[model samples]
Target: MPVRALGYKPVYDYRVDQLGDQGGAQGSILVAGTWYCPSMPEPLIEATSDLHAGRIDRETWVAHIAARKPYRLMPKESKDAEGHQRMMCPAEAGKVQCPLKPRSLGRGVHLPLVDPQPSPTRPLKVCRQRAITLAPEEGAEYWQALDYGDEQWQKIYFRPRNSVEGHANRRKITAWLDSLARGGQRPVRRTNRRRKTKPLGTWTPTGHLTPAT
Candidate 1:
């Protein structure tokens, strides 16, 4: 496959160290066509529900995060200690109360917005133009950029290109998107689990059979 768009099914990466089936880690290629990180949702549901139900305040929630194993608020110099960049971690995190600041919470910690800002700049290697639902009337400026100089095109889309075969790849992707838009085919969400039911009994010479028999 030449870096085509992802289907809507989730992909599971199995791990042995973690207990439970599939190691409880799963990821999905979302409708926007981005690969989401694999995560275990089991531990989060209760805490999330409590937070949303207003049973716990933000301060309490922050404390809960620190309480989790392997996520200590200990000093960076401590053995196996890890923390957000430039944030201070107390030498005796458990013994003393650690002060909470906006910067202390690292990435992926969602908070209610008091002031909204534009999204942070993507890493140089990441694509600025994401997979999106195509519009039939999208202009030539958009399509032409897909065939730009190799370096510029790679930066924009975050993919490698060939001098001879690059145009063909762009055309293929463009045509695929166009067909989807023209046909009004929306992306459908899919789950990884297959349905299971008891097998129907088979007839036998001895007698009518139940599934157990």
Candidate 2:
């Protein structure tokens, strides 16, 4: 939380708890860390749960996620000096479609139009507004600068994590060698010694290996 106050948005994999089975906010559902329309297909809400429960196969769960698109961030003007920014629901942004948002039907030409079955008797705030303003203080606590678990998040999180760890590992190795040197011990360099396999052959009584004719 302190780091967030200093303007750092943490990127992390969704723990089992973060995947919501239902809408976490008045008119929005939380998936990974982002807010989505409450009408996000039920299977998607249940995808992570089903996967962990073994009720669905990895392939099926993967397909579910593969079909999922990322949320679109609104314009720069949506935010002031503060960290708060206006974000459009996935459906409204045209990443996906919902009958609730009539314009969405025309939008998301290449995206899936989900039938929001058993439509909410009373539409939530998000379905009606199409966009929501989130602040760093509260609702956006788990919020990701990049859509969580999407290709962008992977690109943003993985490359840096790997490269940073590589630097740390190298530093540790160097420090260890320095410690060894200070103690008058030579650091042993490791070498790869591959055992060469013999070609197809027969062992003769004279302890000779004869290759096949």
Q: Per-candidate TM vs. native?
A: 0.16, 0.61
Best by TM-score: 2
RMSD of each: 21.7, 18.1
Per-residue lDDT of candidate 2, residues 1-213 (tens digit): 578768677887767776754236656666666666665676876777788889899788777765555433243335657767676777766677677778778763677776654654867666667577766564555666666555677788899989999999998888667555445667665455686875434335454655456
Give per-residue CA lDDT, model 1, range 1-213, as digits (tens): 111112122222212232121211011111111111112123322333445568787666554433332221222232122211121122122222212223323333342111112347531111121112222122211222122222333365443334437889887777666545344666433335565764344234345554452
Superposed Cα deviation of residue 110, candidate 1 (Å): 29
Model 2: worst 10 consecutive residues (lDDT sum)? 68-77
Best candidate, lDDT-wise?
2
lDDT of 1 at 169: 83
C-alpha local distance difference test of each model: 0.29, 0.65
Residue pairs with clashing backbones, model 1: none
* Model 2 lDDT, residue 33, Cα: 68
Q: Which stretches of candidate 2 lie over 4 Å from their true place?
A: 21-23, 57-59, 70-77, 106-109, 117-121, 159-213
Q: Which portions of model 1 show Cα errors greater than 4 Å?
A: 1-45, 71-213
The per-residue C-alpha lDDT of model 2 at residue 130 equals 58
